[model samples]
Target: MEKLQAAQLKKVLKPIHLWAIAVGLVISGEYFGWNFGWAVSGTIGFLIATLVITLMYITFIFSYTELTTSIPHAGGAFAYAYRAMGPFGGLIAGYATLVDFLFATPAIGFALGSYLHFLYPQIAVIPAALVFNVAFILLNISGVKESATFSVFITLLAVGELLLFMGIVGPHFKLDNFMTSPMPFGWAGVFAALPFAVWFYLAIEGVAMVAEEVKDPKRNIPRGYISSLATLIFLALGVMILTGGITDWRKLSAIDYPLPEAISIVLGKSSALTQIFASIGLFGLIASFHGTILAGSRQVYAMARSGYLPGKLAQVNTRFKTPHWALVFGGLISFAALFTGTTSQIIILSVLGAIVMYMMSMISLFILRVKEPRMERPFTAPFYPVFPAIALLISSICLVAIVYYNVQISLIFFAGLAIVTLIFVILGKHKVQILIHTD
Candidate 1:
């Protein structure tokens, strides 16, 4: 009925800040969740899966960077899809991005809680998780620069902790321990472990979601994406090898705080060194939890601003210039998820959403190349169609693998998508026109 103007995001992030947020949004995976793959595929099988996913991310980030820079929108994948494939494509990408970031925040929040519980036996998981969710939401609503600055500080601490973990566990890394039950479920195990492998780098692509907040996004976004990917790849592989080789994978496979458990084996459970590491390691979870909340709110704000969701969600705080409503709404949903699902379950669902988004984004890359050849791309993806094609093919295979191996979660994911689609058809179509006028 009335025109809805898009709320502008503050531009305060530099290349380094963007890199920190990108890596911060995913560094938690290095600490936990990924060991669950060991339960399904053992160390080597999961390693294979991780390597494949690693390639997919490398190609996906490089290609996705082109879209982020060329479009330079806070909507990330949704913006690319909407430009390339219209409303339906935009809806799919937007919803998947929301699901991925929203679920991931809770998973990391649960992890932060578990780490705290480990330090203080009197503290319970759910209460600690709720505190984490609420505290970060407040911090994010305060200011984008403040949030990003906090992320950078904590991310650096997490990186240092990971390096310390490697130094401590390196000498204890026995090849035999790592090789034990490397493929207990055979080839099928690798397929089953795909979701867990995906967790290792799940939300790294979210850097694009903050494109509007970045200064000189065309150059900075690409630098942030590439540097963060390189750092994550090194950290993920090192963590997996050292942690798995230090103890029986089974011990850490089902836990939310795998890095601490692995460290305990090296420093002895009762050692003060073990306690310190565990407590300090909580920074890793904090980094991801806080960073993902920032990303999720931006996605929610973008979708709502564009008329896919309630316009109220896009409202920025006049004093702070942040999406206060979206931040709080996402935090509430994350807390609900924390109470309902285990970290591994949430991680699986988050990966499923990420894979779907990746597939759609890659498709958008191809379509835009063919249709808008004249469009100015400040940063072109190296090797053009090849990189995006590889990313698309791997994402499709992973999606099929996830559906085949995780039927229940897959069904739930699709069911949620269906409900969202139904709502869009009935109500969102009318609002979709608002985006045209606003843009």
Candidate 2:
């Protein structure tokens, strides 16, 4: 892992600013649509699942916070692993993360399509997907400020609608709906929910990607990741439970847009408030996907600057100080996926990629702690061995769940990548020096 002469990161994003971007991306499609599974799993089971995932998320956040602030380079997970392990580890993590972001763009694009359908019933799904791809591309190319501003507005609107809708619908709640099923499919249902559940918990790592741009990253990165993730999990728990209490689980399971339907049922479908909620959900998803494009591209730039990726990918525009090639490469991948199978399938693949990356990240944390005890880390993981160990265990469990859910192709793809990365490592190590670049 040789770091060359790379462009310095412009400190354009503060820690809270990045958190706002992440929160914006998260609140859109995820909140409105996640309850569909809860309908089948029952309220108590769903609540437990949410709690487990949220805790695991915070734990992972702490581990990443230590890595990001210590390194504060462009390659989020990729560079972290490379610095701790070797070029081979870096390549594997980098490629896995690249695949995760690539598929994630389209998955979010497809969500944009679904939300557009809800808004304009007559709009074609294919067209909506393409529109999302192009719109996000333009937004990302424009600059970070433009993208974040739009995202903040749409995200806040969506959050407001979600909170208001939940408040209005809560009074009509029934407790029996939550306790009706006791993990109905037992272990199978838990496995079934794993992919989607993991998907729901994705993107909390966005704060780490902008570490270089953050003001006082040593303090802010850790704070933003835990605080923002905690906030998101709280909202998710409330939405899941309230949606369960207010509506029949049976009906919600049957409907495609469960949250919107629950809102319509409580407020009446013809009401203007109902329409506003639906509209916010629609545009909010587009805005969220837009923010993802912003975060994902910078990671590519980071990897490229570290010399794990093609040199061209690391190039930033002189005027914009933006990773131009990284943005285009990411957009092209998302555009390609737009024409493929269902968005849900793309989301599954993306989740699989993320799971693998998280597993590698956990491993890297242990290795770094053992190998570099004297290295400076502005933020440290709480409880040392315990937090990372728990995070690793949870990640492994989620991997099993993903494989159990029949995403074997994604697993196989990741395995093949590992083999190739090992080959690259052996080939590169003898021929090149492992350089660690810092000012």
Candidate 3:
């Protein structure tokens, strides 16, 4: 093996850019995917699931902020886990984070296709999905600052679209419609819906994956984390309630373009208002699709740099100062996934990976507190053990629920993990090293 040097990332991200990256990485969930929970649990059952997942995220984000600020690495959960638990633990965390972000990118890409198809009926879904993957790869490889600036602009537009969606649909909201078929599958449906509920805020943690690129990470990372979480929580709940209440949840439950379908219910299927909203709604999906590419590539670069994967994945483009190879590799993986699974399957598998990440990250936080008491923490999670404990316990339950309810996807997730672990043992074991660098 040849010696490899760390490819330093530019520190160009501010608090606003970090917040946009965080929210943009997830805003598409408000447009689609979360409604699939309605198919399993019905509106009320999914709501119960969303509420539970929301609590888990609230606590998880607070605890996670401490790790991101203290470590300030692009590896995110993997970095924290590595610091506390060594190479094996880092591999687990890194692999899970990769699974989470990688799957999420394709899911958003698929949604992007669905949105485009809604606007222009002649466009094929797979082709549109592939186009998005390629276009975003170029944008991401161009440079982080350029990509993040674009993300911020699109994210604001997406937010405005949501607010407009709510304004148009609010008057149509009926409590009876909202409560219709509240728990058709009962408790089983609630458990079944966990993955879709997770889609609402799935990649918010990916913000931490960009810590290495942020300006003044100690001050800005926490603000970005908290503000983004707050914004997502509000948007997720608002969209779910308004969309669910405006019409029968069944109409939009399985579709890739739920918000547009919901808008059609009030404005008529062919109304200009419906068409305009659907076209604008594409911005929401674009924000997330673009943002996830930025985050997913960073994770690949960080893992590769740390010798958990092939070194080629860590190479930076000389002119752009970006992880060009990682971006392309991640985009190709996402494109392949676009053909392999339905949006729901993709989402469940991604959430399974995310739950594992949450559990490991919270455990890493606890271990670090005990094992490295003197480590500088610019910000501490409020309520200490309580917050992380809640996050850990809920994440465990969500993981078990997802596995039990979606056994096939769960097996696929584990199989991917197994393959990654095997490769690590064979190829990465000797190469793994503790990376120390100051940004």
Candidate 4:
């Protein structure tokens, strides 16, 4: 038997397996955070705006599809930069990618804990959720195959929950609920919802990071990304519309877990079915958080190995052959997030990371096209300059919108990332490069 080269690992991931991973990414974070956004922004105009936002995500998916197939390596955004722009660009991209995972892992971990509290109202949320995060972390440390398998199971349950919500709660859709403005902020309400809506759509690009692990990545990666986005778009539409319609939008906005509250209203409060529904809902949260941790850690490991991040993170488990160091780093960050913040704060930070990461990754697509036009592209984005250009514009606009609406918070977050960059430079740590032997 021929030993598999790192690049040849793509042959292992079939399109459906890749698609499952994508679905896992899309559903997990938004399951809970969308309510907070809906509450801050009103219902009427927010829904329309979110629909438009989904289109932007679609454009991003297409652009990433092109880039991932062209490079088809584990580094993801970092790899794209490493190949085209050189070490410094690769370092920045890797840093952004690492931060993306760092914040996202903990945000989801904390959300898992918060959602678990819904099921066991008596238990302390942090401890209960910490147990869940630790288990998934261990699973990830064990192997990628295990992580992907678990993601598939989680994705199924997540989809089932979405369908259940639609089936059980769809009938309650009332014209009176949606026709009137539910928030006092009016136009500002829709604008306010942008960040949260963006949060729900955060993980679509995650699949690209794992392109190395998938089989036939050329065909599978694009299929996986497109399918996952399609599923999430449908789910987002269902949840936003059904939740908006079933309960009074004002009431839905008021609760911390609006989807559950909305379901409780439709299923009747304090019923046996409500208990069962809460369990399933919490399961969805766990699934989402688990998927985030798994994907984020791999990206960190990939970046580190490529010399864009600390080489220490590149060490693979001799026994498990997984990226144990990166997994531990991710778990620690997530565990810390549980202590300092509300679920909303974590979700917002995760969204902030995603937005910034997307902007750089999108720009990377254009940069690569210009710099390495002849690189063997197993799959090409349908409209090269057009699709990527649209994605770039929309991501930039969203970043601006994020800054305009939440300047203080956004500024603080970006400042932190910048500071980290400077520290790496000043310490003379990042100047060291790792030579990955890829043939």
Candidate 5:
């Protein structure tokens, strides 16, 4: 948490921008991934899962904001864990954050591609994804203000579109529709639905990754996290429920574009508005794609600055103050993922990274309370032990569920993590440069 080198990211973001980034990082979940829950659990089982995961996020964000405001580092969970648990803890969180965001970009990029091809059949999916992926990397390299500004614009459009969707689909609601085979496999389906439920609010915590760039970390970070969580809760529930009632939840469950398909069912496939709404759905995917690229690169920059990664990745562009090399490196991984994995597998990998990081962050919060008793915490987590404890317990349970359900993908993620950890140990960089806690 020392002052970064001569070049640093500019602190130009306000509460509004943080809200934009927070929500934008996650808005795509509302658009596409969550519906996959129905394929496994049916509508009611997924609803139950979503509610439970939403509780985890509510408590986690409230508790996590304390870490963000107190430390206010670009590393987010990595910064908190390094202070509390030491270098090994930092590496764990660092790698997990990278997996969480880097994989997320290509997932959204793939969505953008599918969404575009749905709108105009002439353009193919993977190539369109590659084009959008490269565009966001370059846009992120340009500057932070530009990135946040785009986040605000695209996020508003995305949110408005969701709201519009809910309004239009609301009239089609029927309890009978939602309750149709609500649990195809009983409680096991709810257990299976956990990952898709996590999807609803997955990357909202990325807001913390940009804490150092906030205008007033103490006040604005809390405002951003809480407000954005509220917005997401409303949107997630409204969209899921309304869309479920519009048609057989099974039909929408398997498609990449559920909302538009619901609209086509409620209106007509040939309706002009259906086409426009489907096209506008691109805004949500782009928001997440661009936002994750911006936030993920900072993890690269922060880890490099602290000697966990190649120092070259830490270098901020002299003209724009962006992490140019970090962005490029992340873009390379994302493009590689674009070619290799299916979207659901990529999401499972990202969720695995996130659930582990959530566990680490909550554990760090507990350790810091005892380790640095007098640290200036501008905003203390309400209910102290309860909030973070609940968050940790739920995240751990979700982690087990995901790993058990997705054994193969989970193995791949852990194998990569182990390799990275081995290299980190052999390098012995942990002994060379210790992280200094600002507190």
Candidate 6:
């Protein structure tokens, strides 16, 4: 009775909600963050990087969907890895995922504020970011159904805005402007740009974090993942290519508000249309902001429920049936992160965490195939070994390249991983029985 009475999430999500969550979680990359790739790789080099990363996501989402449908848990990669590789594997995946979404939250928050500042110069950036973070945290605590509904509405607005942006910016594109210094540092820059490319679809896997809440997840998860990825691939490539050709591209490469700034260059900064478009741009950031908080809290809730963290963190709100405490805890971490670094630095850390988690997830899928061949899978990955192998290979190469190019960031990531591992081991967490119910 006690176990049954414990707070649980309501299964109120449909395919549309999942699609909204999936696309909304990653749409911000189309808005910004990815332009940083141009700074390192130039237009042509970053395009190559983006294409390669796009392939990885295509293979990864298809391969990842099987694990998601088979093990429909809110822990996402953590649950998959834990089930495949045991407690230590679970901890590593959980920690990587926490780093991915938690860090991503503040990065998106920064963009939200930056967009607001771009709209109203006197509003200030950091304070606006802090407020957006707090607002979304509270919104997530309300209820999953209500949150998903809001996600659908906001996601639609964001998607429409991107479409409109493309339409407005397309005519102004100059092929010559885009081709200048197309490969400034040769092929090495493509490798350096991988993290920014990954940003284009970083958290699409976050849909897995809400698998438990999906209605008929076996059928809907694959649909949502496939559709959302298709949409993002179109939007990312179109936005990047279009935005690049409008100006020096170099000028837009380093800024947080690149898309709007690009628009201002085309439409005149003082144009009312430019101002309205900039205001609309906030929807994309808000969508991802909400999605990350929703996914981040679930990862925390799943870990806490399994005794990897304090049990209190798993407590769901009685009336809302949401992981209220987990939401609050994750929000606090994101707030700390807000002061940590620039949007580019935060994006690098988040992408690193995401890549590590992706590698773990692929390994888990392969292991599960061998370990539980008879386990019922409502959705099996197409092309099996080949798809997953490609994803792993590309991800491994990207990981190596990122570390080689950004030695300091790599060290920070590894050091953080090491510290967390040491603490988990010291706490004897590996020996603790972890029971995360997939159903």
In candidate 4, what are the lDDT values of residues 317-378, reduced to their tens digit? 87777778888888888888778877667666677777766777787777777887787777
Q: What is the C-alpha lDDT profile of model 5 across 24-73, one tens digit per residue?
A: 99999999989888999999999999999999999999999999999999
Report the number of clashing residue pairs per model.
0, 0, 0, 5, 0, 0
Segments in model 4 whose C-alpha atoms lie over 4 Å from true places? 1-11, 254-256, 427-439
The TM-scores of all predictions, comma-separated, are: 0.97, 0.91, 0.98, 0.92, 0.98, 0.98
Model 2: per-residue Cα lDDT over 1-439, one tens digit each: 4447777767777655766776765664355445545644555665666667776777887877788788776578887787777777777777777777777778777766666676678987777877777777777767666666676677677667667767887898888866677477665666566666665667667666667777777777776676667667767777777777775676776333666677788888888877777776665566567767877898888776766668898887786677878888888888887886566567667767777788888899899998998889888888888888888888888778767665565665668686767766665742554565433
TM-score of 4: 0.92
Residues 1-439 of candidate 1: C-alpha lDDT, one tens digit per residue: 4455766788889988988999999999999989899999999999999999999999999999888888887788988888888888898999899999999999998888899998898999989999888888999999999999998999999999999999999999999999988999999999999999999999998898788888878778888998999999999999998888987888889988888888888888898989999999999999999999999998999888888888899999999999999998898889789879988889989999999999999999999999999988998989988999999999999999989988999999999988988988887483454342312
RMSD of each: 1.7, 2.5, 1.6, 3.3, 1.4, 1.6
RMSD of 6: 1.6
Colliding residue pairs in candidate 1: none
In Å, residue 101's CA in model 2 sits off its true spot by 2.2
Model 4, residue 65: C-alpha shift (Å):
0.7
* lDDT head-to-head 2 vs 4, winner: 4
Q: Model 6: runs farther than 4 Å from truth?
A: 1-6
Q: List the pairs of residues colliding in candidate 5.
A: none
Worst 10 residues of 3 by lDDT: 430-439
Question: Candidate 1, overall lDDT?
Answer: 0.90
Model 2 / residue 51 / CA error / Å: 1.6
Which pairs of residues collide in candidate 2? none
**Steric clash pairs (candidate 3):** none
